[model samples]
Target: MKANPKAKADPKADAAAAPAGSKKKLMIAALAAVLLLGGGGGAAWFFMQGGDAAAEDTPKASKKKKKASNVKPHYVPVEAFTVNLQPENGEQYLQVQFTLQVDGPEQATLIKDNMAIVRNRVLLLLSGKKASEISTVEGKQQLAAEIQAIVQEPFAKGGDEQDVTDVLFTSFIIQ
Candidate 1:
């Protein structure tokens, strides 16, 4: 290579060229920093959310199992009968047949002995209820409880104190 002594190499232009390479390197470094921060932040957030969700779900899962284990077995015996009653004003009224499953033999005996009173009380309660209330599911449930109370009241008075577990409606018709 031959050196040309007359050629002027401008130092300021060389400085400007150096700055352009440094600017490209700087831009690449900035982009790398941004990507690293975004990727790390997203990963950290994903792990934190997963951890919190697991923690929240654990107690609920345990409680559900506990509740299922603690549940008491429901016992109800079955009996069925239809009765006619003279309501207020001595009107002849028809009642849908009802079946009950008493808890024990003793309770069943007591119910059988006092069938007349139980029937009368049930008829009275059903007579007073509006047609809509007695026909609905909730109303029928309420009626069953009322009958249980009435049947149990006499037994409680007689000192048996045994529970009639449930009243089942084998047949129900209102006339």
Candidate 2:
């Protein structure tokens, strides 16, 4: 059983017999490197596609915005109306000022031309409301909407209809 002292230690054999912790650390480092490279490649691919897609969509979006910007709003003022409201406990009254929002100047002109009929309809609607009915915010909003709908209707037979976008109550008072 004599030991051979001249035998050289093989490096490959030493590495194969490395401790479990050392092997685990090496494997972890290699896995981390692979994952980092894979993640970077995936991110690069995604950004390249996203950039190209955004570039392609930009012109169409800009054209739509330009078209939307061409449409303008027109506002027409209406004279104040003081109507005797429906009596609740006593005589009630409502004084309201109106401004009509139209799609364009032409629509505003049409509304102004038919202002008498519009005023008559609005006065009738207002006179029918009780003081309590027009006191709340919701009631006022509903009244505005109703007025808008009525004002938008055609005033005469074979007449072009006016587009009343909204009825704004500049002043609303209930007594």
Candidate 3:
């Protein structure tokens, strides 16, 4: 068999086919990268703007919360009381002084206006306590709670009630 020496190698055809396949692959990779970046950017923008929109929607509520937080608490002082405690092995007495914590001036005024009734109630409650009942920290705390409850109760003849948030004992002595 004799080879055809006049026929040339088709280098152009091989080059053209390889370059087309490579170009298609390169284009697909580029498209995927662009789509990934675009989707990530969109998600980031949505999350960042979502928080801002919610914050902008409730500005009044935020202001109300700030004002409520800024409001100061009012404290009303009660005169010291010396009451005879229940005898435990001997005659005992308790001398206590406390300040009442109220929400605002109005509540303080309410408690101040009924000082006599409040004092009487507190005295009655304190006089009933035994010396051993108020000797320890826990016992004193329990006594303070009972006193607060008694003082916060509604006054006689259906008077307006007072809200006592806390009872702070300035002085507590059991003798």
Q: In TM-score terms, which candidate is top?
A: 2
Runs of candidate 3 with Cα error greater than 4 angstroms are: 1-71, 156-160
1-175, model 3: which lDDT tens digit per residue? 7777897768999899999999999999999999999999998998876545556467565754444445577999999999999988789888889999976788899889889989988888888889888999999899889988888788866875566778999998887
Question: What ranges in model 1 sit over 4 Å off?
Answer: 1-94, 155-158
Cα shift from native, residue 174, model 2 (Å) = 0.7
Which residue pairs in model 2 clash with each other?
none
The C-alpha RMSD of each candidate to the native structure, in angstroms, is 13.5, 10.0, 11.3
Per-residue alpha-carbon lDDT of model 1 for 30-62, expressed as tens digits?
999999999999989988765455655565567
C-alpha lDDT values of all predictions = 0.65, 0.83, 0.84
lDDT of 2 by residue, 1-175 (tens): 7767898788888878787669899999999999999999998998876545565456666753443345587999999999998888888778899899887777888888888999999988888888887799999888989898888778888876677777888998877
- What TM-score, computed on C-alpha atoms, does each candidate reach? 0.44, 0.61, 0.59
Better of 1 and 3 by lDDT: 3
Model 1, global lDDT: 0.65
Worst 10 residues of 2 by lDDT: 62-71
Q: How many backbone clashes does candidate 3 have?
A: 0
Cα lDDT over the full model 2: 0.83
Query: Which regions of candidate 2 are displaced past 4 Å?
Result: 1-70
lDDT of 1 at 165: 54
